[model samples]
Target: MIIAVIDGMGGGIGAQIVSNLREELPTYIDIYALGTNSIATSSMMKSHANKGATGENAIITSVKKANIVVAPVSVVMPNSMMGEVTCGISTAVAECEALKVLLPIMPEDVEIVGLENKPLALLIKDCIKVIKKEFNIK
Candidate 1:
């Protein structure tokens, strides 16, 4: 299966997701790191993603082939990630055919109701649970 992990800024979140997936998921699964910049992509690449891409067009094109798209909710919000995420990138991710697994991370000036404030590690573990269930992984 193909999984895409999308992130921007420092790409710390994407890197962690990639590392967790590599450690827990089967080796046959393909993990793609899609970042808004080269620095972000490089960080995730160090986590051992099978492939990595950066920039708006790269994200738009790569997500199309993903079986699963994992990212923070900000990825679908235009002008998010301190303006690193463009309208085209947000539109592409929001409209992609892949099953989306978004973490409930709110950006500045945004608030999501009905979600408890959880630690980042806990949220990431929850993400892994969803991935495992979706793919029927042991």
Candidate 2:
């Protein structure tokens, strides 16, 4: 399966996701790191994503080919990530047929009720759990 992990800013979250997926998933599963900037892509690559790309076009094009798309909730919000996520990027992700596994992290002004306040690491673990179950990893 091809999984695209999308992130912006420092790409720390994407890198962590890639690293954990690399360690926990089967070797045949392909992980693609899609970033809003080159630094973000590079960081995820260092974490061992099978492939990496940067910019809105890259993300828009790549997510369509993935079986699963993983990202922070902010990724779907146009102009988020300090305007790094364009409308096209957000639309592409939203319209894609791939299953989406989005972290609960969001802008300060946005809130989703009934969600536990968890650390980033814990959220990622939970994200992985969902992916594993949805993909029937076991």
For all candidates in order, the CA lDDT equals 0.94, 0.94
lDDT of 1 by residue, 9-117 (tens): 9999999999998998999999999999999999999999999999999999999999999999999999999999999999999999999999988697999989989
What's the true lDDT of residue 74 in model 1?
95
Q: Could you tell me which residue pairs clash in candidate 2? A: none
lDDT of 2: 0.94
Worst 10 residues of 1 by lDDT: 119-128
Q: List the residue pairs that clash in candidate 1.
A: none
Clashes of each: 0, 0
Worst 10 residues of 2 by lDDT: 102-111
lDDT of 2 by residue, 41-130 (tens): 999999999999999899999999999999999999999998999999999999999999999889888899999999989998898899
